[model samples]
Target: MKIYTRTGDTGETGLFGGPRVRKDVLRVEAYGTADECNSAIGVARAAGPDPMLDAVLAEVQNQLFVVGADLASPNDSPYIPRVSATMTAFLEEQIDAMETELAPLQQFILPGGTTVAAYLHLARTICRRAERVVVSLAAEEAINPELLPYLNRLSDFLFVAARIANARAGVDDVPWRKP
Candidate 1:
């Protein structure tokens, strides 16, 4: 199929199983943000510091696509698969693994590293923004409970992943302290 679905020419796009909504709708915004996060993760994957990190990031990118799909569906639609607790659990597991390898966090850390690690940090920040937007969306409508927890865990995972990538790549994390 052609990339341009001129069907959205009028600033409206189709939901998963319903009539079109304005491209600016909260659902659209939330899913769009998730898509952006996925792309950012791709950047992190390409800058692989190790095989393990690359493998995990590829998985996260896939999960992000599932998240975007969930957000894109209408509330009344029962046909879509929802984000599940298992996914959240997996993120927590990864976070724990990465944290195990990181130095104790006594102070804030500035985001930078080998170019790839810095980019992962940037993706992590965008993930947080995506989480915030979804939370706001939930506040106004019925959203899958899994979404909040998933995003929350995802942000933590991304932070640790960035640190791990930098450390494994032989880059120092710029620590933040009272100057």
Candidate 2:
């Protein structure tokens, strides 16, 4: 099928099992940000070739698609997978594993190091934005209860992953200095 479906030409998009909504709606915004986060993670993955990091990010990219689908479908859509606590736990597990390799944080750090680490930091920020948007969306509507926690944990995972990337690259995190 051609990429241009022309269905969204009227400024509205269809949900997985719900009616079309304007692209500017909170639900759309939340998923769009998730997509941005996913793409950022992809860039991070492409920036370097760490087998462990790449494996985790590959799983995360797939999960983010689930997140997007979950946000898009307002109704109970059998086809769309809902975010679950198990997924959040997976992120927590990864974070714990990665943190084992990182030095304890003594101070705030700037969001850059090796190219892969920098991209991971960028993805972390976008994940935070996606979390915020999801929060706002949740406040206004019923959402998967697991989603907020998942995004929250995912951001934390990204932060630690960035640190791990820097560690693997033999680069130190640039500590933030009070100016």
Q: Clashes in model 2: which pairs?
A: none
Residue-wise C-alpha lDDT for candidate 2, range 2-25, written one tens digit per residue? 999999999999988888999999
**What do the candidate models score in CA lDDT, each in turn?**
0.87, 0.93
lDDT of 1 by residue, 25-124 (tens): 8889999999988888888777765999888898898899889989988665667778999999999899888888888877789988777788788888
Clashing pairs in model 1, backbone N/Cα/C closer than 3 A: none
What is the C-alpha local distance difference test score of candidate 1? Answer: 0.87
Query: Which candidate gets the maximum lDDT versus the true structure?
Result: 2
Candidate 2 TM-score versus the reference: 0.98
